[model samples]
Target chain A: MSENRVPEEIQENAAHEAAKLGIGTDEWVAQHEERTARKKGLKGVPQFIDESIPAWARWVVLLAAAFAFGAFVDNQYLLRIGVNLGLFVMLSYGLNIVMGYAGLLDLGYVAFYGIGAYGYALMSSEQLGHHWSTWLSVLIIIIGTALLGYIVSLPARRLFGDYLAIVTLFFGQVFVQLVLASDNITFPWADDYVDITAGANGIPGIDPFSFFGHKFLNIRDYYWLLLVLVALLTITISRINRTRIGRAWRTIREDALAAESMGVMVNRLKTMAFVTGAAIAGLAGAIFAAMQSAVFVSGFDMPLMTMIYAAVILGGSGSLAGAVMGAIVMSVLPEVLRVTNYSEILFLAVLVLTLAAVGKSVKRFTINIVSIALIGFAVKILLGFASIKITPTEEWVVGPVSRALSHWMYVPLDRVLWGNCAFVILIVLIAYFTTTTPRIKTILLPIIGYLGIFLWEVRLVTDVNTTRQLLIGAMLVVLMITRPQGFLGKPRVEVL
Target chain B: MSEKKPLLEISNIDTYYGVIHILQQVNLRVDEGELVCLLGGNACGKSTTLKTILGMVKPKVGKIMFAGEDVTHQNTPARVKLGMAVVPENRRLFGPMTVLENLKIGAYVRGEAAQEDLERVYDLFPKLKERSSQLAGTLSGGEQQMVAVGRALMSHPRLILMDEPSMGLAPKLVEQSFEMIANLHSQGVSMLIVEQNANMALSVADRGYVLQTGRIVLEGEAKELAGHEELRRAYLGR
Candidate 1:
């Protein structure tokens, strides 16, 4: 709105130009809005909101919010967790471009993150690797991540919808598996002579980020570091989203055929999204490695994928706030799970059940319920059979279906009979309640759901088994049936 | 007609989409300030020829000469910058944008002094100024078409190409749209209009070409084309 204000100097200058052009003030304004609307579409909610918040003013709010969150949480450990969450916010924002704006799902986002992490780790660590200054390492990490992103994008740009996703996921999984399987390569930065990535023990005493000879070793310093990165990431993404390139991405997402018909180069836009998202993930990885003082293969777990996606979905796909919220829940949930007698599985179960019970009467609530139930079921089944021993599991990659079925069916089939009954009962209850005054019947649903989740979680299920994977498979089916968009993600509309 | 030399010459243009060859050896020419109409029924390659001229698609083999320069290999933006403008089929106005934004993007290929063209376009279509802030998509079909035309005009193009501007229009709007085209002609802008309504197109056209399948089967002065027995029987529903 303040853009309405024209200083006298500008008005005078404008008047002189107008006299030469022989055009009136009203005409100029009308044409400006017309041009802007064409450049920015009607569904452009982000830019509309962004224009209202001035840059300098926003920074002050960001700093205040960060410090307040740090001070109020009071625990240095939690604050450290918060810093990690911020790092993920940077990562998710990057991922949002490829997966959100460009409609390209990239599962190998973390591989770029690893590149940056290892770029810094190998250069900065003094154990089995050569030592370099933190500043130089930081530069190397950024360049390395960008290069990795570009390399991956060459193939990724050609893919779209689900194929791109599967390939990227495969790419990321292969990288992690290689690191885990190859002990020779990982130990270069290890303290021991035979350790690369310290063989799961992980390298330690990698120097904290030292720029211009000033080291940032404390949580407070790390918090500032994260804030700076998050802000830069947000600004860069926001600007890119508003520019001509961003318009091309949206056009492609909306209708690729129509976009190409309009002479927009579709391949170029897709490549930009893939590369940019990878770069962001890489940046986050570098910062994370610096904070943790080491890189570990175990850090890039499959469960971390679920958590990051959950955050992205919960916050709102393509929305920065959604990414931030998603990262926060993911980074902190495990820690919170550790503190309570209720395991992380139970925490998620309870959270989901409560949401579903409360959401039952709401139209479109069933979608949320289904996804939550799936997540809960996943956690429940995975946690229940940690004690069951497995024999003769291969070290390298297994075929997907076999691997999936093996993971879910590992424990004694009878042990999960109770879980099957409970899951069936929940489904029956959901189905039965939908027909009549289900709202009134399930008035106490939230309490009942959380109690069910709590009862299962309090038993401290630890070792992951086949039960979790089955739950996840069930969850995917439920998602396709109920809320194809998943909870909090915008349902995709197909307009021919 | 002054018998001025043709500024744009098209020869033996063959355009294909996969197995469907849309334009076959389509030869056409336009002298300076002449309004030409490529008239046909729906799906008769009138639109495809316009697109080929705009460089939206490459011809299998043809020479497109603009001011004696070969531009068949040029891209859309390059062609546009060379004083070419198109009111695309279906009037693909940027929907969520204001009427003004629709016009602005039309002149997007134009450099910094685009405001001059913007004013010229608005003066040409006063209705656009009235609903300047209104989202182009929400506008009535007729109004949207006006925005599309105004947008093309914003580029200050020497030659304007339009495709099916009369599609899905009420009779009155269609009449007004043709009148506007005639008015544009009076302003010295050369035009190549592709229209399914042969009657309306020939009314404003200095000359007309009748296309069937992908090739031009008849070419003559507008009056002669209008009076032709075969064309009238085939297209004008005589």
Candidate 2:
């Protein structure tokens, strides 16, 4: 209907350069959508995002919305989720400094978080014989973590590439081993063996942070505290990124040899990055320990680390705002999955969003939804003709949506074994769906969608932990494909 | 000419990539305020020489001197701090950073005068001044090359080494970049430019060294070497 504002010459020039750069012509969805929108004489949503709101203002607005969300929500579960989101935001930012800015993959990053939590537990708990003040404990923990980060980084100066990864990963494993087995210690000429770490039981009754004698007692209190800290951290980190140190880190990230030949102290700057990440992670760990009033070795393991990494990667590393966005989505998602009704809504909502976003046109998206619903009902009718009645347990289906879904879909009476089979079948169908032609793809999608719903209603929604992990894994895969630079990160190009 | 010490001198340098020799008995030099070119085709160790001088590649046996001091053992940053700045192959500007930030990184060793040096770079490349806030990756190839040169200038080095400045630009832009190089040379900045663009480089350089399979096969005034028929066929691709 309209001639594109972007001229043919500009398009040719971009394609020419992209070819020279060896790019395969695939671009991020947001960028591709904007061009399509311009071609169709319609203004894209992101055009406003790109041209009008500066990145900093967007961050402020988003942060303000988060603050508002925290201040108003009265549900303790939601507030607890809010607090956990805050911790993840902090964790992502810290890891962003090391992995994103400096391009160092420190697999043992969570060890520093564990260290900080345990440090606070020891300092502020009655088990340590004398409870220290919260301010002093926090100060000491931060300082100690920074030093620990520096010490750990010293041995890595000689290692580079994958060798560095091996050393750091081993360090992470060592931290877990120490925490697990450090139950008792016998000193030479000592009368008895002492329990330094309280032996696997974990140190509990950690004192909450108190400022001006006002202790942070409620979930909302920790949420507010983290919000302010995150704001401060975001500002401070943004400023740091513009300094001489930040530039050096970026140069090293781009090309370490080139950076070194350009006069950057690459090793030292890398270490500084490690120290910064560790300090931030430790601070988050301190808050997390206080929130639960306990520090457990089991809670600070590899899976928790994966969650933090997911947030960092999801948001795009090297961006403060990206980290926050990723953390909020990831932290809130698992909590939603914990409740059957909420999870069902979330699942359907995500499915709808994916279908709408991925389909070529509105008509196709609508048709797909209708076809999926019809396919499910047809399958149910066929099963009914076989004289078998399938109904899910009533206890798990309380919501109006489930009640509506119950009437049309065949919910297995004994779901666990059948649900497992459906999940495996769903996976195989999804794998095949990717390989089929568009015509076959259209035919197969409704079956896949119906199967996905069947598996979720029967098995997945009930197994919250496994489902959350699956969501996180799925998020990582989708993020890597759709936006590798992360939502707020600058797209990077490597020459070799 | 032989009595006066060269600003930089590399003698009998032998380098290896694992077991394979990359640079064999390589020798080259850049006099103060003189524009020199190391001309070669692919697999001729042109890049290895630059890397050796920058101390990114340690020579198995060699002596590298800058202003009469041995620098063969020095690491890259040490060489850079000792007044050697490089426009690495393909510009290598921090792609994610602003042009201003790229210049700042170039002057990483000179912390106190970073601002003043940045101003000087902006003066040399005035177009860079107008677009200093833009990301380096977003700039055109010609502008990126200018930024690379400007970044080198910001380091305030006694010598600047550039690798393949004309590799990706249009022919007209290549001519313009060469003109800029000659202009910078006229302003008393010594340089050793490494290039596969022999015709363009020889036009600007005072002296030329044609490298083949890690050895210097020809060395003379740029004008005289450009006129050599066989050398022209192999390297200039005539």
What i-RMS does every model get?
A: 10.9, 7.3
Clashing pairs in model 2, backbone N/Cα/C closer than 3 A: A316-A486
lDDT of 2 by residue, A230-337 (tens): 989999998998788888887877878778888888889988998999999899999999998998898878888888878887787777777887888788877777
Residues B100-194, model 1: lDDT tens digits: 65565555444333667767877887777888876666566677778878877776787888888788765557888999999999988899988
- The native-contact fraction of candidate 1 is 0.02
lDDT of 2 at B54: 89
Q: What is the C-alpha RMSD of each candidate to the true structure, in Å?
A: 13.0, 5.8
Tell me the spans in candidate 1 whose CA falls farther than 4 Å from its real position. A1-63, A71-74, A126-128, A155-174, A177-205, A255-270, A301-314, A325-416, A428-496, B3-7, B93-140, B150-158, B168-180, B183-185
> Runs in model 2 with CA error above 4 Å?
A1-51, A62-76, A158-162, A189-191, A210-221, A392-396, A494-496, B1-5, B18-21, B112-126, B129-131, B227-238
For model 1, state the Cα shift of residue B90 in Å.
3.2
Model 2: docking quality category: acceptable
Q: What is the clash count for each candidate, in the order shown?
A: 16, 1
Candidate 1: interface RMSD in Å? 10.9
| Model 1, span A92-164: residue lDDT tens | 7877787767767777776777767766676778655667887677776766677777777777656777887
